[model samples]
Target chain A: MGEAIVVTSGKGGVGKTTTSANIGTALALLGKKVCLVDTDIGLRNLDVVMGLENRIIYDICDVAEGRCRLNQALVKDKRFDELYMLPAAQTKDKNAISPEQVRDIVLELKKEYEYVIIDCPAGIEQGFKNAIAGADRAIVVTTPEHASVRDADRIIGLLEGSHVESPKLVVNRIRPNMVKSGDMLDIEDVIQVLNIDLIGIVPDDEHVIKAANNGEPTVMNPDSGAAIAYRNIARRILGDTVPLMPLNQKKGAFTRFKKFLGIGG
Target chain B: MTVKSNHVTIKGIKDGLVFLLDDQCEFSELLNELRYKLEHSHQNILTGPIMHVDVKLGMRNISEEQKTLILDTLKQKGNLLIRSVETQGCVPEDEAGSSLHTLCGLVRSGQVLRHEGNLLFLGDVNPGGQIICSGDVIVVGALRGMAHAGADGNEFAIIAASYMAPTQLRIAEIISRPPDEWENRESSMEFAFLRGGTMQIDKINNVGKVRPDFNVFKGV
Candidate 1:
């Protein structure tokens, strides 16, 4: 059966949407048929960041209501053949859908796609529940900050209780300068608080912002550190144990095995 | 599954109520009967002195589903002393976060309800359920469930019981228990108070000094 993965973070502005877009794109580039669902419902961003906002004629609500077929609501990514996005309706709130319904939709999608990556909202409220109800695994994204880490811990507790234990961790936006100066929590501290295996450690790359502004995922950029991290994470999802990339250390530290990853972990 | 204990004697125990039902009848049928009787025009189940119920099952015992139905039926009958206990991977500190009562009438297992103000529990607090407070935690009936006061770092919090014997008891960080050596001791009226960051519990005596035997007559 296809695995349904959810990208979630309890605190807002921890790059959940950005991770969702880039990770889904990276997975599709790996030749896995992936469907990205923006389950935030009202305050949606998968469409906007994907730069497919203007092309949307139908949203997820229309599919749920059966006004359109699932195929009709699916939007193809221009860059990847297998990647598709089901955008949320800005006009509706989270309560417009049911958890059972989300589960049913994910179950149906499992039959057709290799992966269904859901973009969860920023809180532990209805939106979060709606996004994760059908997920088999989850990726908790957090900044290297105490508040975000604490909220991520709480979300991990909820996920464990809600039958989605063993969620992987993604530490986004690591500014090496600040971490070295002890002004911010480093990767080790975040991992200790979260107590989970690390999947991605994305550096604060300006290339990501540029790519987003240009409607392209940073993962599409060959030299971008964030893109490389996302690609590694996507490879790790395929059962490859890619070592985490060294940050601010010598680039040639793991040079022998680096090219063997071949643009992956 | 039966109503706990092979022999159930429906009788008065001190000022409390105890209905012992033998483990023979289908729990659903028994609960349906209780609900019907309580809702009956002549029989007012809520007005009587609150009762304590102990279900001792035999052999296969009652299914988790049966126990849930019984608890729900008791709640529908106005008030229930028997609370649902979810013993799976929980701790004593969880008692601070349980309301077991209804802000909404629906109480689900594994869901914790924490209120900071003076608390009133309209329903039974199940075993896994907790009712911890910075103020007084008042269970309107039999308190066979777990409860703690001054959970938000309040040391003066005192825990009162209609019928006192919890699987675990806590007031703030202090934990109280009947002496570990005495497992068979049962009680009806007891109170636990925090003394020097440790919990000390004693039976409340209406006449003289607090007596430990006062808890011997069980079921609130």
Candidate 2:
């Protein structure tokens, strides 16, 4: 009954890991049993980002290769009781596990958890293929840049090719001032290039970098710009109708009047 | 021909044995040497090892007569597979560095297609996908990726697309980004080419009159 969603972006360094960690954390805070699976294999960072790297005695390869039980490799997070992480192996190659193996593991995880969020690796190779094998939905994270937008378009096309219904988009690290000055791609431009349903837009905040470096996800920082956006996105995922927060106070007069009306702000 | 040289040399490869023929040797000499080696060294080359022997005729402008002669000789000896016959220096005059290539599917992200002649794409060139050709490029569908026509410094190459909202475009040495007010852009069959010193995009409203630089299916 649980939904397994794969967080993927064709291009690297576009916040797939950040989105995965934050969204997983937000869902767990909402009282849902969540498990984040890192399928990046040789370059695993989801455990480090979730601050659960030290608790890993066994990893995904160990469970897939029959060396340990699935529950034994599931690392419980210190912050949330309902949250768990299935860390990837650092020493093994990407070809160590197959798509069928990942599908079987995710299927087993789905039986116990309400949300199984998979962190897919970059590129459309074997690792990306294995990560999305058993997912019921997809979330494509991208930056408001030309390369990232194009990559998001391709990933959306690929997800649709695999019959994943309408992958959602999360435009990450968007600088409002630059977008205002026409120096960078705006949210509208990113959406136009990708042509997917917009779910969230995380601003380019330096606190995100600090939180990630401290082995903490940005969603835990309530004062951070990305945190509010991620929380709103989580609320939306829970089927709540929440309006997006404005980037700055440069709204039109009509929009400002609507914001004061208590209907949406 | 009474050949007096060992023109065929067989080496052990991971998949099979590769028989390399010297390019300077005559076709009749190489064929005679290959037949002699296959008939005499059957026990030493193909007896116990579960392997196939492949002939590598390198850089020689082999004719149809020479290819059939080699295939017939190999078949009369044993059940052998011809791995490849690579002619390094024998590309045809028209096909050398100037032949049209048609890519028939969606060009995915991180995929690059580079050709020396014109390119005819039959699908969507998604973002992050690049197509660099030395001649003109014609896309039958959306062109949202980066495309560089006339990559070999031919400034007269034109790029035509059904949906021409490309990430970046380069014709010869000039590059241009799409205008910012392109949000309301429609599918009007646009084409890009160099005018004066800058790249200019124009709609293909009149298809009857051909431009001075435009030519179809003509290359070296």
Candidate 3:
């Protein structure tokens, strides 16, 4: 059976959906058939991040309510032939469907796809319960902040109760400059608090926002630092032992001087 | 199958059935719904000669008057045997139900763990999580959450951990804290217990150094 992994973070705006879109895209590019399920319900944005919102004729709610066939709700990705997206309903609240209903939909998707990526909503309410109910594994996304790490620890606890594979953490929005200056929490600080296996460490890059605005995943840009980090994460998820990305890439004094002179940075 | 009500949710627990009261519903509506469920929808499990049900209030700070309103409603209904009423923050008296509970994993934020007896945790307790027990509390790993060792007012209860930097610690009715300078003592293992009606902390290595009068063990 295919693995159904939920990308969840207890705190909002920690890049749960962004990580879902990019990782799903990266896995699809690796020749794996991936289906991204946006379970955020009313706050659906995975479709937009994947640039497939306009193409969503049917959604997860429609499939759960038997308003459409599961195949009809699967929206094909424009960029990857093997990738598909199951968009969540924009109008329906989290309570529109139960956890059992979501579990059934994910089980069905597991038959045809190698990976069923669920984009979970924030908070540990009914929405979170539904998203995790059908997940075989979990990817908890967090940033290098006290509040975010605290929330991530809670999410990890919840995931552990569900008996999924120990949830791997993805520390998003890391600024090397801030870590060098001792202004932000480093990977060690986050790992110390969470005490879980680390999967990826994505540096803060403006390319992620630009790609999202264009309805494309940052992983599509091969040269972006964030893209390389995400690609490594995708490989790690596929049972490949990949070393973590070095966030502290120190710039030489000559290179810094050249950048100050407006030369190629 | 049991009834599913918006005001109250019922599920079969180990001790008995648990009635969860949703805080969002109107108080009157909640009472009406609770009465209706007990009368009509309890046919499936309530068919037994004797039944015990525990009521769980939602995870919110409830007032005294509200607690009485719920208790009065359940008292009036003689059909189901009301076992106990579990509030959100109040630790139950029977925390010593299990002689000892050994949890092999970390306790995360927003999770409340209560035991009737001693609690032996094998992992860390992150901030925002709580462990309340009527007996002693022990953690093999770091203890950084709220721990109430004497929830049932047992003054002799002690809380021990490898690295104790708890956000809040309590023994019996007293809340004592060591100096902030003691935090981050990685290699030191410490235990906190009540002595002369005041909580005192001592390192495991220096147990014999404590005052002889304070070393007296109380009867369980």
Candidate 4:
């Protein structure tokens, strides 16, 4: 059976959907059959992020309500044949489907897919519960801000209380320059606060937004830093010991000159 | 006139009247004598202003029903109001409030770990996490969250942490200032306590100086 991994963040707008899309795409690129499930229900966004909105004939709600077969609800990705998306219904609320129904759907999908990725909605509500119902593992996404880190910590605590294994953390949208200047919380600080195993760290790359706007996942662009980070996370998810991507960019002329003169290490 | 055996003796003290019941006599004889003494005592003693009566059950193990019977007999005397019942020897330690409890794990945000007695947590308390203890609280790891020691109103309770940067610290009813005003970014271990109704944070090394009785070691 395939493993179900839920990508969640307690707070909204922390790139949970982007991370899900990129990771699922990267996994498909790694020769794995991946199925991405959007559990946000009425507030669906994963279908759009994956550029599979037009292809969604029947959603997760239709599959759960027995209106359509599981295969009929799945939308094939235009880019990767191995990647499929189970879109959430735009008209139905989260209460339309119970956790048991979601778990059943995921179990049915797991038989065909190598990795079933569930995109959890923000907040610890019914949507979040439904997303994590079938997940064997969890990935908590957060920004470097204190608010995001705090919410991530809360999500980690809740995940521990559930039957899922200990969740890993992904610190997204980290500004390296801001961290070096002591203006923003660093990776170490975020790790210290959450106290969870760090799976990956995605830098604050402008290309992520551009790729998302174009209805393409960042992982499709091989040159983007965020894409590379997502690929590394995908490798780690496959049980590969991929070293974390370095956060520091090349030094400036002044800084290199100072280092050459032995003014600072 | 026959020599009367003193089974129950009443003595007057500054605060109240002490009813010294004999420990060696049979309980039935003691009860009969006590009843007779209260019934035949001087009228002035029984009719005057209310007198606080303290019953001292020295070296006697009495049941709840028997103690209630004694109190009822005393209450029959109109002017005698029973204040307290005293028993000698140490009380049993069956209560969880008097023992130490150890918890080993991370206290994450939005999680509250409440305990009745002393708590020895072997993990970090992240921001927004809380620990409420009726007695002392000791965190062997970092304490970045809120800790309220003496949650049940014990003013002598103390909270110690290896890396003490708590967002809030409360000892009994007194709460410390915000973390920004604490100015306690020292590298050494620290502990918080209440002194003179004010919360104070000090190094763990000085805990003995502040509370000499805190040490449990008598000697080797």
Considering every candidate listed, which one attains the maximal TM-score? 4
Question: Which 10 residues in a row give candidate 3 chain A its minimum summed lDDT?
Answer: A243-252
The residue-by-residue lDDT of candidate 4 on A1-265, one tens digit each, is 9999999999999999999999999999999999999999999999888888888899999999999999999999999989999999999898999999999999999999999999999999899899999999999999999899989999999999999999999999989889989899989989988888999999999999888888899999988999999999999999999999888755789988898999973
Model 3 bad stretches (over 4 Å)? A253-265, B1-103, B117-120, B176-187, B194-200, B208-220
Docking class of 2: incorrect
Candidate 2 lDDT, tens digit per residue, A108-193?
Answer: 99999999999999998899899999899999999988778777877877887895677999989988889878999989867765
Error of 2 at B4 (Å): 82
Lowest lDDT sum, 10 consecutive residues, model 4 chain A, at: A246-255
True contacts kept of 1: 0.00
Residues B133-188 of candidate 3 have per-residue lDDT tens digits of 87889899888888899788887677889989888889889986666876656668
Query: Which of the two candidates, 1 or 4, achieves a greater lDDT against the reference?
Result: 4
For B65-88, candidate 1 gives per-residue lDDT tens digits of 876775676566444475223222
lDDT of 4 at A26: 98
| Candidate 2 Cα errors over 4 Å, as ranges | A249-265, B1-125, B128-142, B146-189, B192-202, B211-220
lDDT at B23, model 2: 67
Q: lDDT score, residue A91, model 1?
A: 99
> Arrange candidates by TM-score, highest first: which order?
4, 3, 2, 1
Write the number of the candidate with greater DockQ, choosing between 2 and 3: 3
Instruction: Supply candidate 2's per-residue lDDT for A126.
Output: 97
i-RMS of candidate 4 = 0.5
Order of models, best lDDT first: 4, 3, 2, 1
DockQ of structure 1:
0.02
Candidate 3: deviation at residue A264, Å?
A: 24
Question: How is the predicted docking of candidate 1 categorized under the CAPRI scheme?
Answer: incorrect
Q: What is the lDDT of residue B207 in candidate 1?
A: 14
DockQ of 2: 0.22
Residue B68, candidate 4: alpha-carbon lDDT: 91
DockQ of 4: 0.68
